[model samples]
Target: MVVAGRIHRRHFIIGAAGTAGAVVAIGANGVDAPALAQQTTEPQNGKALPEVVSWKDPDAVIVHTELTVETKRDKIGTSGITPSTELYLRNNLPSPSEEAVANRDSWEVSFEGVQNERTMTVGDLKRLGIETVAAVLQCSGNGRALFDHEASGTQWSTGAAGNLIWSGVPVRTVVEALGGVAAGRAFMTSTGGESLPEGIDPQTVIVERSIPADIAMERAILAWEMNGQPVPLAHGGPLRVVIPGFYGINNVKYVKKVAFTETESDAAIQRTGYRVRPVGVSGAPDQPSMWEMKVKSWVTHPLVDQQSGRIQIFGVAFGGNSAVQRVEVSTDGGQSWREANFVGPDLGSYAWRPFVLPVDLSPGTYTITSRATDASGNVQEEVTEPNHRGYDYSGWRRLAVDVTVT
Candidate 1:
């Protein structure tokens, strides 16, 4: 049930309570035995095989059947905040070593291109101040699974997203301590700490991206905590950037460096990746980079496989850099729409708002859809244009469910 404009926290407790035993068993030695077993599988030819660890959550609804993980829509509202365990995982590279994340307090983030260039340990950051914010962290390719044409990346559906509460100091606070951005720097580039395979050239690998200086000095956060707990390694543990109202890619995880630069980073990930282009468009320069998230909504209840009757339809709506002004639900495709009642208080401009609509229907097949309008007057589109990499799709999402009303 929804309350105070947020999913009731009780729902998450109950859902997690069911798995508490398993969590304890697997976490006995503070190790993921299943993951370790998978990594230790032997090859028939007796050759040493590279370790393969699966980051997929067994309880989550499988969307891409690969690195891209997504939560079950029906389970989304169980908690006001997505539980860290239930949260989706998206990694462009293999998970870093535990040894690297063990000494959380010792993890240092280097700052450059400022008056006082130096490295500050996580402990040093804590002494400055602490702030908290509730925001949504969603993959740019979240709805790629629904694209008419096959997409090359993770085919995530509705579950590749979550609303989370992050605790840390504002990135601007740290920047100010470094004597602020250098005179000519217009961008702040962040890099992750993951190590690559032996043969790969470090230069060819692009794990860093840059954001405009304005954004960095605004709502960006250097978060070390999630849901009141230390951020786990699987979720960018030691330190990560949390840029509210922006796509998850912009919130680089396991951050190691923050560089202020006069020009955008030339890193391949910064220049060539995360661009939205038409099917045949090949170059990054020809496409626009995804920054601010677009206004979007999702219908999470009466899931695609749910039986319908007297149902209460509910889901989430979020606007990038603006408040969600209103939400509309359509029971008959896009033919008709009715305003949905929003539940919960407005967390912030960057947080997702929950909306509910109660409906009575007869036995039949139905197509349900949701659309949102931001306070800035931006409305969600009925259809999203197909792009080459399937990035930044904020189109009205449709849910088809069969009903056997008795």
Candidate 2:
């Protein structure tokens, strides 16, 4: 069988892993509850969801967009790094004018909460330093559609996530050069430069987020390049913020301003939008923010018909911030599992790992799934914890696919 035009070195499993059984409805009080009813949703509103002509991949799934796009699972081959042309698009606002991106070096970004506040051109930042890091760029609402309840917002599936390489100047490097962060800062807030439309309250929809200062200091960077190319206009060119380990919301696209604040930004997106509250509760500042990601893995290949014997199973596994320690795949719906082998070079802990498992099957029906464990020892959850917005769905249940072998 031609598997994405590539083959991997086989690493046999020493033994099988025991199953964790099927997911049953249980509440916080530890009482068995009835299952949440399945929900059906309507297409997103606004202008018709049109194809992104600029994107080279014809097979891309155009979910709901103000330019929102997703990579079809099968297209996410065994490669550890996702290509720039293949990356999913998740724009909150329209791209800046052609004039703004016409020249790459002249784009300006301002820095605040330092001993001195100042603005600099992208060309100027290129002179300070350069660093390259590979990371997962997943939408905060990536697995929304898999939730049993109607959690509102774009209904996304596994396609809404990808791992890519970023090149940029470290946030700490630039901050130190500007005489270091000013005292009393607890949060590092970043803002996008996209122009806001009229009639809407600017505070309600602006793409601004404030993450803990330590997170920003440790892994944040002012990225000018993605997947080795200059940042594109459609994908937050000529500059974006890369906050490794945090959800995509905190890595503001088209980042124009970076400031250190004593409190989180009061923007509605930060205070109310991405907050994770109980299914029926309203979002608030007191609720958990969709900041870091959880451990996730999903089957990607062999999603179609198979002919049984020696078939190879493929999927992706990653910890939101930590390195994945192992991935186990089961053909019997988690009743039994075999550890999978990692394919390709390790792209570092921030990126996802492509995994493969080989098994022989007779003609019949089967349900296949995969579960991941991170370096922190956090195992992928068997079910998503329902939230008001349906943020990150990392469970392997909905990720599984039914297959038939002739």
The per-prediction CA RMSD against the true structure, in angstroms, equals 8.3, 11.8
Per-residue lDDT tens digits for candidate 2, residues 1-406, read 1122121111111111211111111111211111211212122222333332243343334545557777666667786877654567788778887677789889898999989899999999999998999999899999887776787778787778889789999999999899999999999999998899899999988999999998898999999888767776777888999998888878887788999999999999999888988878987999889889999998876666566577778888999889998999999777898999999989998899999998999998778889999999999987777777888888776678776666
Please provide, for model 1 over 1-406, each residue's C-alpha lDDT reduced to its tens digit, 9 standing for 90 to 100. 1011111100111232343232111111123324444443222323332232243234433434334456666556623466654567788876688876689989999999888899999989998878899998999898776666787877777677888889988888888888877899898899988776688666557578788888888888899998777887767888898988888888888899989888877777778788888887775744688788888987766543233355777778988778889999987666799999887777888888888898987766566778999999999866677788877766674332222232
Indicate which candidate wins on lDDT.
2
Candidate 2 differs from the real structure by a C-alpha RMSD in angstroms, to one decimal, of 11.8
Candidate 1 segments whose C-alpha is farther than 4 A from its true place: 1-57, 63-66, 304-309, 397-406
Q: How accurate is candidate 2 locally (lDDT)?
A: 0.78
> Which pairs clash inside model 2?
65-68
